[model samples]
Target: MTDPSPTNFAAPWEAQVFALVVSLREAGLFTWSEWADRLGRQIRPADGPERTADYGAWLTTLEAILAERGVAGPESVAARTEAFLRAAEATPHGQPIRLENDPLYRP
Candidate 1:
């Protein structure tokens, strides 16, 4: 198989989210086929791909699956997103970004 382009992700967080999704799947949370179908639907939604971050659509799909599977709820995801953003904003630049211990992140 051909290697993916080094610039496939628009940002570092996108790559991290992609890795998280793969790790979840590898941990038996879902099958490869399930991920393929869900991600395909997200990539080609009724409104078509949004003119935004490359893997933003993929992240949405992963969240939806996680919510449906009871791994996390919509509110939890939103809360964590907000919490992470807040943490990032508070952190000084040039330091490694870290995920905060958000009460919303159950896992």
Candidate 2:
């Protein structure tokens, strides 16, 4: 299997989520179907205001899934969330840098 270190992931959130998923899978807390069902239920909105996707809602869903699987406790989830937010802040916005001077590219 590939290394599970955070540095192996291109994105911090991906690493965090991957860790949670792996932990859950190893623990055998729930089958894949049950995990999907729980996540789907969390993503869905109850009757009231217009339903929409939001960052908080997405994080909540992830947290709920992790909790259901017993992969992460509240403190761990909070720490991961903080790290995710920090990574988001550090990441660049807009188009990626173009390496036009590289020999691999001929334009």
Candidate 3:
């Protein structure tokens, strides 16, 4: 039987994150049940805002799981995020951003 869940993404990054999660799961990084449990907690924290279909939460959960699994620690993730931001800032309009574009890029 075919699944009927909505597959629409509001942004390209959302689709990318979704694909990353699926790839990681397929690679045995984590199970769907574990992902769902963590994602549920992230989406419905007692003091947090109620969220539904929040791709941002998916990203956050992915990061957390990766860190928990020693796949990529927070420091590395933060550094990469900074590098991407710098690269984006250095990129000219209508140009694709690349990490090599970052002023501090080495090699």
Candidate 4:
């Protein structure tokens, strides 16, 4: 049976993550088969069974692969993530969130 319900990304970040994976693949960072294998392992770790459509796992897998390929270090990603979090928190409701909005952000 197939789901009759319309399927779409629940949030903008989900779409962004999907696009990022596609863009990376298109750029030859990794083959589609490699991506599927890594994503499968990520969703179904040795400690558990396959999870259903978890985009968080997708993001994690992307991060891991990027780090492995030396595209982005974990420290840089973490710092950027933290900066975004701070900026999001500092931004007023209905305003766009920018890294510059972060209180600790300089230049």
Candidate 5:
């Protein structure tokens, strides 16, 4: 599914999920179905609990996968995470204001 955010990147949490999937698959840590099942179970109703899906857990899983694959490290994951955060912060608040285009409408 496509995210509606202005940026063409996944949200921070979504990125983590994607990374997890990739890391696991590359290392043969878990089958796609197994990973999906585990992640689905992690998500819960927002107001349900103080502790929910932990991003750290996902990172740890990724690290384990990398280790299993004998890969160098998570340099790429860190870079992607920084980029996603920058994009999120750069997004503007509320609707874009066009004074000449909407002269009749006043904020």
Candidate 6:
């Protein structure tokens, strides 16, 4: 699902989500400490040491924060997420995904 470059990331989407978090904070939507608290609460891995990227959870939390702050509706985020997944699912393996429009998960 990924052909990564030289980076310590489990998946490409993790970097995208991380970048979105930083951008949101830069846009004054939330503070870094608040993100720490929220993300800490969100991370409850079943296996304590089986570490891997959890971009799905990260994106879910991000959407929740956006909803809490009125930056975007939860339904909107869900719709976009579903569409993104649908696009990815339809794409052949090892090919680039193509979304119908600009993603809602970006700033």
* Most lDDT-accurate candidate: 3
Q: What TM-score do all the candidates reach, one by one?
A: 0.71, 0.42, 0.87, 0.87, 0.35, 0.63
RMSD to native, candidate 6: 6.9
Model 4, span 1-107: residue lDDT tens: 37897566889899899999999999999999999899988888788777864788889999999999999989999999999999999999999999999999999
TM-score-best of 2 and 5: 2
Candidate 1 lDDT tens digits, 32-85: 898878877777668755344357777888889989989999998887779888
List the lowest-lDDT window of 10 residues for candidate 3: 1-10
lDDT of 3 by residue, 51-97 (tens): 88488999999999999989999999999999999999999999999
Off by over 4 Å in 3: 1-7
User: How should the candidates be ordered by TM-score, best one leading?
Assistant: 3, 4, 1, 6, 2, 5
Cα RMSD for predicted model 1: 4.7
Q: How does each model score on lDDT?
A: 0.77, 0.59, 0.92, 0.92, 0.56, 0.75
Query: lDDT tens string, model 5, 1-107?
Result: 47665663346766766665776577776787766555454454366653344565455555555655666367766655565555555545573433323323234
lDDT of 2 by residue, 1-107 (tens): 56565355556665676676667667886677775565566667586554344344445766776666576878876765565555555556663334332334345
Superior by lDDT: candidate 3 or candidate 6: 3
Candidate 3 vs candidate 5, TM-score winner:
3
Off by over 4 Å in 6: 1-6, 44-57, 89-96, 101-107
- How many clashing pairs does model 6 include? 0
